[model samples]
Target: MKKWLQFLVLITSITSTSALLASGGIGEGSEGRSSQMPPVMNAKWKAECSGCHMLYHPGLLPERSWKAVMAGLDKHFGESAGLDAATRDEITSFLVLNSADKSANRRSSRINQSIPTNSTPLRVSETRYFISKHDEISASTFKRKSVGSSANCIACHRGAEKGDFSESQVRIPR
Candidate 1:
């Protein structure tokens, strides 16, 4: 009976360890081992949205946020970004599908977790994850001519459009 109990305990330990590793383990902070957002793309979203401003990855926001953003196209950040019904619906679906809540990437998962359940933020800059990460950066830096603003991730993160926000790749413009 003692031998059986010992064997069971050993097996349990090994199984739990294996499961942890398989699920990416208890990674560094909630962001895990990688800060790279998954590569997800939609032609309509890219063209229409990027035509006015930088292309934001869908993984930056949750499904609810995306839904709210989509529903208010006419007043998008105080801009008339209204699109035809078909195009709007397609882009909405694409955004919702790849939103942080649905993305498998660790960084996206962290971003999703940072949001309060009752909150649906339209801007990534408004998320707790973004705030925590940029806590050290001052408002003056964001307002700098070279930096433009916090929303201009591409200004500092060269690979922003590509969904890469790796710490090593960040270069806040002076």
Candidate 2:
């Protein structure tokens, strides 16, 4: 076999195994939803949480930044958004405690450490990993029903919660 072919096979093997492990398919319990969702910050924060797209933990931002983002929600990214005063406080507190510094998860801290600039989108789809993966996808392919913009997490990634996006899970819509 060619060297490149062998290398590709090796990578495929490792990726498949990792996905299975991450999804807990081996000897583990259920796949959908964890036994306990991470704690919600304030009621307000919980109210505004989104499960799809960038399901980022609020702790990704410093307390001060969260406060700023919450405060500016009225004109948030040129959109109207807001929360009740009480809920705002809850979100602020949650973010403060769980912010990157307090997080044990690598994904949560990765954004803060790597993304040095603050003038970027919050969604993980904008990151280098996401961009490179989708770079070769043709425009026609993107417009198809199977694949939307590069932002659609579930398009190429089947079981993302388990942090697995291998070919085994990929279901490129025909």
Candidate 3:
């Protein structure tokens, strides 16, 4: 009986530690192991979101931000992106389930931590994390025809769509 009790305590400790780490934190000490956000696929999300714009990985934003985006799809970033009720709900579920706050990736966690709890930014560009990383690049640089805009991560990050934004691979086009 005592041995079983000890085993139970050990299991509980492991579970608690994993949960805390997975919740994401600035001090996660990911040691480069979690820098890449894992690719998550949902057929509906891919088809519906990528038809007009870049396919943003769900891990880029927190759950609240995604919920707000989904709720306001009719006026999505100045364009109508309305969908059938069922499609909307499925995409919303996919996004919320894989949002930054729910991710274990170090970069995703950093992005999640940078956001204030009271704010739900629709654009990832509005996040403090994104601003800090791109602060060195001038507005004109993003406005360049080759770059299009800051939202066009693919302009510099060739692997942006694949969740591989390693600095080593970045190449800003002139």
How does each model score on TM-score?
0.80, 0.50, 0.81
Candidate 3 has its poorest 10 consecutive residues by lDDT at 21-30
Best by TM-score: 3
Query: Which one is best on lDDT?
Result: 3
User: Which order, best to worst by lDDT?
Assistant: 3, 1, 2
- The superposed Cα distance between candidate 1 and the true structure at residue 103, in angstroms, equals 0.7
TM-score of 2: 0.50
Q: Evaluate model 3: give its lDDT.
A: 0.88
Candidate 1 residue-pair clash tally: 0
With a 3 Å backbone cut-off (N, CA, C), the pairs that clash in candidate 1 are none
Summing lDDT over every window of 10 consecutive residues in candidate 1, give the lowest-scoring window.
24-33
Task: Summarize candidate 3's per-residue lDDT along 59-171 as a digit string, tens digits.
Answer: 89999999999999999989999999999999999999999999888778989999999999889999999999899999999999998888889889898887767777799
lDDT of 1 at 163: 85
| Model 2 CA lDDT for position 59 | 40
Candidate 1, lDDT over the whole model? 0.87
Of 1 and 3, the candidate ahead on TM-score is 3
In model 3, pairs of residues that clash are none
State the weakest 10-residue window (summed lDDT) of model 2.
28-37
TM-score leaderboard ranking: 3, 1, 2
True-vs-predicted CA distance for residue 111, candidate 2, Å? 2.0
Candidate 2 Cα outliers beyond 4 Å, as residue runs: 1-43, 51-55, 59-65, 117-174
Where does candidate 1 stray beyond 4 Å?
A: 1-34
